[model samples]
Target: MVEKSKELKEKEQKILSNKTQSIYALALLIGFCIVINIIFSFVNFKIDLTEEKRFTLTPSTVQMLNGLKDNIYVEVLLEGQFPAGFKRLQESTKDLLDQFRSESPYVQYRFFDPLALVTVAEKNNRIKDLAEDGIKPTNLRVMEENESTEKIIYPVAVVKFGSKSIPVNLLENSIAGFSDEEVLNQSINLLEYKIADAINKILRVQKPTIAITKGHGESKPIETQDLINTLSPFYNLKWISLDSMYTVPDDIKLIIMPNPSVKFDEKAKFVLDQFVMKGGDVMFLINRLKIDMDSLRNVRAEYVPIENDVNLEDMFFKYGVRIQPNLILDLECSKIPLVVGKLGTGAQTELFKWYYAPLLSSNSINPIVKNIDRVNAYWTSTVDTIKTKTDIKKTVLLSSSQYSRVQFAPVRINFEILRYDPDPSKFNKPNQPVAVLLEGKFPSLYENRVSPDMLKTLTDIKAEYKSSGDEAKILVVSYGKLINNLYNPTQSDYMPMGYNTFEKQLYGNKDFVINAIEYMFDEKGILAARAKEVKLRLLDTVKIKNERSFWQFINVLLPISLLGLGALFFNILRKRKFAS
Candidate 1:
């Protein structure tokens, strides 16, 4: 009996051990499956509910990817500190590439520290054959500083499609040239486009190019580096110093002539005229007066009128604006400054008048200025609509406020001397035209000139895109300073309505620029950011002091008290059921 009992106990122990092992194994298998499901969830997650539905792609980017027969590699060559506010720029860039990766999973991306890798540096610096099957190489510069040597991101991104490879350069931020805020802002806006452009170029697709005229006192194409940087991401911007190369390239899309102080010679004029005749779009920004530092010396800032030997009267007459040999000054649209002199308060705080250069409101009706708020400009001219026979459609993109006035060329007024008291006799009307827009079919500059250059032809001062009879469209802003980039105003140096170089952001200036370009290129996606509209009204002190605090406190404490009561009840129930 003792032997049998002992054997039975041993059997019972073995059965318990087997049961425990089986239970543990089942739990592990369930836990493992749960962990694996979590892991796989992240890898193939789809944010878009309609993943199979077709999405619209930017025309250029779509073309590039479709054209690619092979693979392209994107190598980031950055390893160092960047300038102020550049971290955000890099993050935004990476975000854009991430978007592209999701769309084109085959696009290979890699990053190498060019500072540490000599082989990568050599490959980027060398001009290797990429266009045999049609490819282009791009170079990028990233600025960083070390203890001894300053390091820059000088990396080349090579795009390989079939036997062709194209390289593109990336910087902390910039298009082709360097930019200030305008360039930076634009780069941020078009990050998606830059990637598309890079990939497309690698795959060999036709890209539009912008040709900027050089010579005279036109801002050095480099100074407008900001301008070039913004546009280069979307269009291939080419600088054609008319002095050096008299010809405009065939692929040139828009020509920006901002405040050209000098005259255009016949050679230059001929090239411009021919280009326009070929359906080229032009943005004409010429100053009517010569601005000098001395002009601002007297009680009021003075200006010299511009005298052109070859007047674009005929062209402008057709388009509709006449560049009077005078400046357009407005009483309604003026910026106030701390006029250097004051009697009682010393530099008394008062609205030292500036002309009516009212901020242009974003016109949801028009695509060019769709979401653009305002461009900081002063002493802007009024544009008149010229009744033209051409079928080209025209639209006014900018204008002064209803209460505006005009200043003739010979007029003299000092912003410093305008006191709070009125001088009704000195200033003009309540409202006048500062700028207007004319769109329609434009005749060529050489149409009636003896070897006249089209670009300098100035055929339509009031109208834009005169070449495209029905298809051609032009955008004309009377003030050159709209694109001048004179200086951004700072808060201290700025008035309630002032132009501060350092302080003022491109609230609307950037939109105007990008919109103008997009309009010229006929791309509708250019202007989309909305201006901030905050409406705040402060309550009286008595209203704030009123006793709403008691009720407010009760509301806050009620939820917590309810939860505590429920917890206490649950504890009691647990004590009764399982406390034994």
Candidate 2:
């Protein structure tokens, strides 16, 4: 009896010790959790395991956001019942904004349904209000029960900082020749860029000023209204005449001289050359071969190439590039309406490949044109980088495809060329450069060419002339139609640049132009971030459809079967322990 009591007392003591130790462990775990929570409250930590680091923000974007002084309020108008594609876009937008908020506490966003009203009057009123706020709606066709239904959805976000707000369209409606699904995919891919661009625009101070030369036959306001609309928010755009002003305005940092039909006189040429000497950037959209498209509207359609008299050849040659007086005919080109057959009163027109309108492909890895879509060029001439004694950085920005040929000046461009099947042997020239970016110090066009007598013309303005200039950049395109907008008489509004009314598609003209300008002025690599791409991993739809029911059966039965087996084994083990 004494031995039994001693053993029982020892067992009780051991049980008490174990319980006390368990309590201490629990307390320690709770304390550690509390400390971690406090630390996390003060600091933000995140790990992105995605293959593309989709959750991570770019360094440039983070830097821009961190510099914010005021609170930014974004109203995303993509809320409501949407299809799967749009829902993906909405989730992406939210995710990107969340990343922004993580970087900067000043960023805040809210979702709103722009079409939630039931009454027609209320809906109209809401639409009017949204339009006034620059939030427009897009139409979508959804299929339900084998019936197609049209729905109006708003895919826009209005970002406001301080008193300025800019609208960012979530849908890439401007990418011509893309299906609805493709458009949405591209939009999702560009979500980060679009949002960051808006934020940068609103936060920017001291917007740069650019001049559009008007004395020559440059594009009119109506023709360039779309470009103006895109740049007005970030640039102070103006039309400066070289005829009236001897020198470019001091405030103007860049000049855009588009397609001048008339020749540049000596004074005008001198002013432009002096502008370059004064460290000014210029973008020249010139055409060497002048072929009138409107003249080919009749049945006997023939277009004879004429020499364009815009005299900037010597100036360009001195810089780096020479605009060849030849046109590029590419196998991969834009489409134009062609007459296939004649009906009683109307001609049956069909879309045919117009080799003259080459869709210039950008194989360049330059940030300005990286991953950008093809540019549509009408009567685009080829540009050659001159091998000069001076050292200048010349980069090819745009070129034709492998199956391209050069048509020398005075070549006949008639409708009959459309009927002939092009032989592959004829198109041997591969990657013909059509657009180029020239950078570095440029020698003055009048360095030794102009005489002392010509110097007297500028006697009124007493300024020392420099033979060479500081660092500058110039973008030269052998085509000018990329910036031209067509007029729609019925709507009485000008179509956006890069839009083809006949094909009802939008091209990459606007994006290229905007990106070029942005790249020029960008000191923080905002445009460089646009080259980021996230790989899309999608499952095979055919396999999913074929194995759907079998997968459903396995998913439904496997868990329950395993649970029953686990319960039986646990019960058996408990019984064995007790019985022993």
Q: Identify the candidate with maximal lDDT.
A: 2
Q: State each candidate's clash count.
A: 50, 1
Tens digit per residue, CA lDDT, model 2, 1-580: 9999999899799889989999999999999999999999888898889886777777888888888888999999899777888899999999889889988899999998867766889899988988887678888898888999998888999999878999999887645455666667677767887888888888877888999989678878778888887788789998988877677778898899888888888788888888888888899998897665776675275777788979889888889889988888899888898779989999998988888888887877687785467888888888999975467899998899999999887787788887878887898988899899998888888887776766665665765566788878899998876677887657768888888888787778888898888877876767766776676566889999999998887999888999999999999999997696
In the predicted model 2, the residue pairs found to clash are 176-506
Candidate 2 wrong stretches, greater than 4 Å: 142-148, 174-182, 297-301, 370-372, 388-391, 448-462, 488-492, 541-580
In model 2, how large is the Cα lDDT of residue 96?
Answer: 89
| Alpha-carbon local distance difference test for all models | 0.53, 0.83
lDDT of 1 at 173: 29
Off by over 4 Å in 1: 1-209, 214-217, 220-225, 228-251, 262-271, 298-310, 319-353, 356-358, 364-368, 421-441, 445-473, 485-499, 502-511, 518-580
Per the 3 Å backbone cut-off, how many clashing residue pairs does candidate 1 have? Answer: 50
